[model samples]
Target: MGKRFVLEEYLAHSTSNVMNGITIQQRCNDKGNEAIMTYVDHVIQGFRKDGFLYILLTVAPWCRFFPSVRNVYKNIQEGIAKGNALFDSLIDQREKELDTNRPNGFIDSFLVEHKKNSPSFEKKEQLRIFLKDLLAAGTETSSSTLRWILVYLIKEPKVQQKVHDEIDRVIGREGLARLDADVPYVRAVIQEAYRVQTLGPLGVPRQTTTDTTLFGYHIPKKHTNFKQLMACAQRSKTLAQPRKV
Candidate 1:
């Protein structure tokens, strides 16, 4: 929960910087965290539910014919649609005030680049994909990683105590921003956790460029080995298994 809060604030600030400079965190605080989280949770839910269907669609485009899968896709699209109004308004605001002299965030940056006459750039579609990736993929990955960290800490109290003691000694009353080269253990713990329980068990899927043979098995062009990657990760001896909370 705490991690989720921090992630939301980080995402909101990062996104808001580009959109207009109106910090969404401040806006959420004025309104209420509950409202913001509710919307985010719903959107993340749509992302989680649609994950399998999305993979299926990539591997077998015909799966879209299935009513259940189609419904899930529709719902996911609908969830993204809910945020379209707000995002579009922000984009519009940025469009009206495109100050290349002082670009605020990514939206402004994109606007500046769009003016560069880049033939390959499709401004609107790129912006939509970028926003969707940030809100949906970023939130889920960050929240899950933090949650996994806590799980590890809870299961291993000695490590947790060491971290606490280190923090108390190194940071004292100072905030995390005070952390510097002196914080090796803190970084180590985070790195180890990332190695063991990465939220993305499988790395990003990639399509084959051409026909290939691996271990006597034929792989056609455009075939994705994302599932194979996930399986290998799961079987990795170095990856730690989670203990009961």
Candidate 2:
């Protein structure tokens, strides 16, 4: 409940809040589309700009649950500092390039929107939060998904061959698959891969808001606790069908 209150306060007033103060007009505009598109574009740009594929790859899982994964990120930062000097140089160069090129990218779009909305909002601070959220949430999860998909493809060569054959017949080597393209097989493969990989092994954690009674037991108010384990609650053999929450 305290955390929820803090989140609400941040959403209401924090200058760095990512989802705050977005207008419907802005959502319906080309600027919005560009903002969304540039998110992915800048990440790929950052990867290329930095030449830190391994770091980018690691970021995928970290971003999925940023609130919980911050400690992990701090540890990683410390570990990287103790490693090869050339890698550190590459990271520094990437940061400089990002700082230089950011104005031409998503940060620019966001700044344009912010200027239209609240002129008082500090654009630089907002940009920092926006970039952090994008890097932590966007790049990491997608990269991890792609990594798992590639691993699955490697494990099942026949599936890979079928996909390759389809690509050869349709787009060929020179062309790449577009998001709007009618690629059912590709979509199906991705769906199956995610289903098998199951990124949220434990699912997102939540806390009870108030005192509640369940199955004749009194759960105290403001208790930061998770529900009973699914495996413990339901018999494995009896679970034939999955029900929606």
Candidate 3:
């Protein structure tokens, strides 16, 4: 189900940098790599803990929280600071490279929008929030999904063989320059993995603005949480049926 967690770490670092120009060291024989991995580990731990604390913080943020929760919050704030620093560095670097033909990442895109839109301070704050989300969500979802995919692949050898055969037929042994969108079976396997073990087991929370009825069970406008998606998916009628595989 895993590859020693380094794959997840590398993916997280690389994607986060792609999004915000943060420079994380690659898995190399260097002290910088160690520091990069340590920072990423902190950020990842914060992501894991934030989900549990979000419910409590959303409802009663003023209440005394656990020391561990405080630590997680601090770790996330530190990560945010690192991201902000990277954003500033990218802005300066981009300004100097205005005439050069370099590829733009997410931060570059944001910089262009900042000039065109003249975003407000609040908008800048929101952008920072999105940067954090990009880093955390990218890490969590990809890693979690891959873990589930690995489990399924190991459990179903025929399925793995089919995937191999398909890859060979479509992209060949040399590997793809980029994955084709027409690959149905590969996409299906990922979709199925998401259904079986959703990364965000708890669905996104929302507040009711007015009284409403949902499946004939709700009649109030008060705040409430939705049923966990993973639980519902597992209990779904379609999933209940036995499969030939």
Candidate 4:
């Protein structure tokens, strides 16, 4: 009967639950905020649709050559386009309200620097892509990593017990885990889960200038998402979907 709470709203309105001392509730227009909240669902659906597309591309690169794949890819591209339009709208609104004297959040901060014509900020498209990545990767990647951690913990009771003991020692029964918290064994358990089951199998693409090798891995001049190999070496890893980067 009531309205659903969305991630955008939570980030905008929350006072303490977020990080880096940013909130957009005060900065954004009420009408724009309402529109953004209503649109968040569609944006999330687009993001999930993109995830499916990524899986398809990764698993069956050959399918892309088929005629039917064109329609399927176009349909998915439409969904992604919707997400892009939503961010573009949000960016437009933020640009209208952005104040350099005191920036609102990440976008505003970036805009301030962008006004100075920073090379990285020269491309607004990059910022849009970053937002897409932030929303998509930030949510599913983290939750998937946590899910894998639980799977491994349940499979390995000793590791679970060590994590539990470490939690008790460091955070205690009542304390919530904070970013600033120090808990090595628990962190190691999470890290080990990452190693055994990599999250970002296809990491962000980066091209090398010259052929280079690091940490027993060889790098060619072409682009590489080394997690393709890490997925092979997964002794521990995190923050990536089972999907290739």
Candidate 5:
């Protein structure tokens, strides 16, 4: 995300000579509109290029999940930037603690499990590969999704206000809203926003693992490729129906 912003800054700074036939000093204002747009475009492009590659490979079989992951990352980034100091501080503290207590994280967890199951395998080397996968799989998508959510909330004041109202009603002023708090409406809003504004429109692609039959149709393994169309699914009437799980 930071990389993207930097790219946008470069582009804006390079092309800020004319605005409505008047020359404006591109560098004169610290917060120029052109600068801001450049920064944003840079960030977006950077994410689309580098971030998308790893996500594509790691979750290739489930391409549909990429958009969701990207949105999560975007939202997290926005949340941190918006001065969610508590969340920022907590995440930083957790990283520092983990560095000392368990540097491996999810990769380490996977390695331990695999080692227990397959004693003959080389654990350390396998752990390195797993760590690569973990980092690629874990970071950007979550942050992107978060940032995207923040962007939507900022754009839609009514939705944001409704969410705030729900939060206040459920948690009260005495405490902050926890994940477990009763805020179904807030959750719904988040889901609806994602549905309305898909961060990853082109989802993962899938290849059949084996011959399969579905609805009287036969799909041969290695011959069938499937791409999950999220936009189509989100618009389905069946999904619109409200029901208890």
Candidate 6:
């Protein structure tokens, strides 16, 4: 999760800009068109909405049939399609200009692996989905985590003052925080915030492919996360490359 990191770097390194002509991006940011929501704001709202609907789909089976819920579901589906399309355009642009010999960034790295015919990178759809997953999910989670971090910092003025002092000492009061700065106390505060505000206590939801025993405990087949994974896989026409449990 790069937070503001990737977008900041992407603009700097990219010779050929990403499809900056995106209508949705423009419309979202345009003052006359609608309320101001930057691209990150849109991603966060979209993720939050879809997550709520997923919870409904998981627990409230009857709710999916309701007209309002169905309408929201349709909108979410459309939003996802639009997002994937944006990523598809980005991938297409990069595939043409990316230097395979000097692989750069996430897309370039994946494209290089793809050139080698790795099973995980078999389809361009895989690359597209990977981009969407990394960019969208990373933006949402990192933004949410930062929100938690700010909340915690506000509650502890001494800790906040220490972070301020560290920043002043390391980068100067006038200097901006760069990614490379070694601020142990700042890092520790972030880690503590992560511990205290545990998002997803069970971690990402996992589902058993088949009825299985984990440490003599029976886990049923076909759970919610597996269903979601299958839906995404179906869209990508590629199986997930799970590197670790």
Q: List TM-scores for all candidates, in order.
A: 0.70, 0.44, 0.69, 0.65, 0.48, 0.66
Q: Write the residue-wise lDDT of candidate 3 on 105-224 in tens digits.
A: 554555566667886665445555665565555656666677678788989999998887877877778865355546688778878888777777666667788898888877578675
For each candidate, the alpha-carbon lDDT, in order, equals: 0.64, 0.48, 0.60, 0.61, 0.50, 0.59
lDDT of 5 at 43: 41
Per residue, candidate 5 scores C-alpha lDDT tens digits across 1-245 of: 34534333333333322220121223313453443333334444556665555455445535435775565556435633532333233234434444334434443344446545876766545543333222222233444555566677778788888888988888887877577889998898777666665555665446788999888989998763545456464654666532211
lDDT score of residue 103 within candidate 3: 32
Candidate 1 runs further than 4 Å off? 1-39, 47-61, 83-86, 117-119, 178-182, 209-219, 227-245
* Best lDDT among the predictions, by candidate number: 1
Off by over 4 Å in 3: 1-38, 47-103, 119-123, 177-179, 207-227, 241-245
Q: Any idea what lDDT model 1 has? A: 0.64
lDDT of 1 by residue, 17-62 (tens): 3322222213333343344345556765654666667657766778
On the 0 to 100 scale, the lDDT of residue 218 in model 5 is 92
Best TM-score among the predictions, by candidate number: 1
Worst 10 residues of 5 by lDDT: 16-25
Clashes of each: 1, 4, 0, 12, 30, 0
Q: Per-residue lDDT for 146 in model 1?
A: 69
Clashing pairs in 6: none
